[model samples]
Target: MASRARHGGQAIDGRDLKGKAVISGLGLTEMGRIYGHSGGWFAAEAIRLAIDDAGLEKTDIDGLLVNQGMTPLPGMGGVDLQNQLGLTNLRLLSSMNVGGATAGIMVQYAALAVSHGMANHVLCVFADAPLREGRGGGAAYGGGGQQPQPRGMRGLYTAFGMFGVNARYAMAASRHMGMYGTTNDHFGAIAVAQRGWAAMNPLAQQREAMTLEDYHASRWVAEPLHLFDCCLVSNGGVAVIVSSAEGARDRKQPPVYIWGMGQGHPGDLNRAGWDIETQTGAPLSKERAFSMAGIEIDDIDVCQLYDCYTYTVLVTLEDYGFCAKGEGGPFVADGKLGPGGSLPTNTGGGQLSGYYMWGMTPLAEGVIQARGQGGDRQASKHDVVLVSGNGGILDHHCTLVLSPHPA
Candidate 1:
């Protein structure tokens, strides 16, 4: 298959993009709320488990990547975490504030660190509690956690409303729905397929089987988006270990090679309708990513694109060249993404069912899928998997291509 050209414009100018990194370990907490532990506790637990999975001690991990601003529980910030975890001597530590894309960004950063010899082992962790502690009541929307409501326009209050703004624009942009050959059913199919996969995994929340009828009858969230279309505000932490491919010799689990990774920041704000291909300033993060991986679309055995909303996944499919422009709806509807199909996606149920650890859960899914760690029900003999994340209303895109251990 021909390599998908870079977003068709603007040559990339950055560090060399040819070296390979490897994932040596993976760790994650349960999806639902664990009442006693705080956010920091989740982070610490994830890190500890990830290190143990790698068959290494805490001293083996020198780099730390996490997101802190979420769930204002005690010890949230990166430095606070370092102090809390007693890792004050650590070398590289940074927090990814890109929201949903935090996990993907953390992966990219850790890979870069390993490739450059900045660190021998990088531990990436993601954790948070649901808005309402599974009592079905908390700050389900505005940011996260059980915080008081903001009557007037304020800080996090404004950030909470930002998604509503994105939804409004998405609804307005629906005028092109007919142009794209998309429909509510297309979105429903994506949701149902994910829910099906979630049922197989013991970790997913909404394991119950869903039908098209159930989807259509579901309550509305932002119009065009049913209640099931959006992810739940559940709590959990997920982590992964990264190391140089050459150094994975003694690892307990098979190492999944990091083939290629890239992130994009479209210059447009939430309201703009800029055509990504034609616009000079619109960053083609996905294009650069595919180029770095040196692979074609058909080479990807499975994919996990961020699905904060249906449109997020749709626009990403088009932007990333998964299909021609405006073809995501039909591309996903062809029934090739479910079991025994061309590409089984979200085998872990995704944020929709598995757990809402941002898109971190999807990143873990990609890692496990590439490593052949997925159990019999969702596992297939696939080598390469594409994990993509969307943050802040499609403003930032992160793509990582992973391959099973080399022969």
Candidate 2:
């Protein structure tokens, strides 16, 4: 039970923090390999958009949290960003990264800050532009895939067993397949389904129609992991504004209350009792998040799970109690994650077909779904939304229970 003793930190840590803070605004930019413009530009533009979305001026922002990605924008997390935004005398300022899990963690910390009166409105933003001219995704990430042979220290490290994300996640998919009879078809189903949702999103990078056949036809990124099975390598930014529930209620956009949140860290892959293929931190995180939100699994209307890969989605679904340990393949292959399915997941195409802003991909879509602004990708029931973020080969996890109705 010590693992499940979740607490929202800050000055006021005794009372339940559910419904104490809300995400009042979201800002996004054209993502996925957009040329030019550094991450700082995208971040600044996103913050401005978020401020305007919340009907707040630049000076109204008292706090800022920046989530750094593979390619950190200059002056992103320090006073330089503050100066760029013309925000003076900030009460909160910090830069953080827990790989992809930072988005939900950022919101959780922001909620605590505002709920404890540390800052009235906190801005959380993440942006990355890794692709250089003529280089493919592999070059951006540094691997043998689709790029020239590694050079210098990178080649030495690669020789020393340092691998890219594709290899690591591909190994996870292979392990799951070996243990649970999960197959390429199951992963393909996720890819095709999210692609269907992407067709409806204006900001989605890959909105083309896709079929199961298309998924199978895609080239392999790491066997068992196709190009489609992996998430898109994107260049973009996403920003969210967290405000006190009282302050959010009067904002321009509808408030998506932060009912409950929890985080889990299972430690390094070498750690005992930690298995990347069969287990993750989701078990403990889900217990605390659902308990804090005062809701059961069935109460969830939609899921915005971090989709770093299709396999990641399937494994996470099983860990979050959506299906039994080994049944995620069939659970997702049933066409349930696509639009109009019983369980709509990754409605904005997710990172598979949509732009990848790390955890902000799910967090942004969760906010949109909670606000009923998902357009054709919006689910019918948006009362309760579950958002999940996975970091560092699923070693770190963050779960957030959000809803349109205050708890």
Model 1 segments more than 4 A misplaced = 1-19, 73-77, 133-138, 142-181, 269-283
lDDT of 1 by residue, 1-407 (tens): 23444445844433244446788888888767557767777887888878888888777778888874257534434778777777755668877688777788888888888888898888888878644544552254533222356444444544555345336435633643746657888888788888878888888888899987898998876677777777766767788988877767668878888777777776564355764322211126655666776777778788787877655656666666767777778888866666666778778888776777886877888878887777864466667788887676556677887888552
Clashing pairs in 2: none
Model 1: lDDT to the true structure: 0.71
- Flag regions of model 2 displaced more than 4 Å: 1-15, 144-157, 160-162, 269-273
Per-residue lDDT of 252 in model 2: 89
Lowest lDDT 10-residue stretch of candidate 1: 275-284
Per-residue lDDT for 1-407 in model 2, tens only?
34433346442222388899999989998888788978888888889889899998787789999987777666655567778888896899999889889999999999999999999999999988887778887677746332256677657645666467788888888989998999999999899889989999999989989989999999987787889998888888899999999888777898999988988887665667667656888887887777778888899999999999999999989998888999999999989999889999999999999889999999999999999999878898999999999998788899998999887
In terms of lDDT, model 2 sits at 0.87
**Which prediction has the highest lDDT against the true structure?**
2
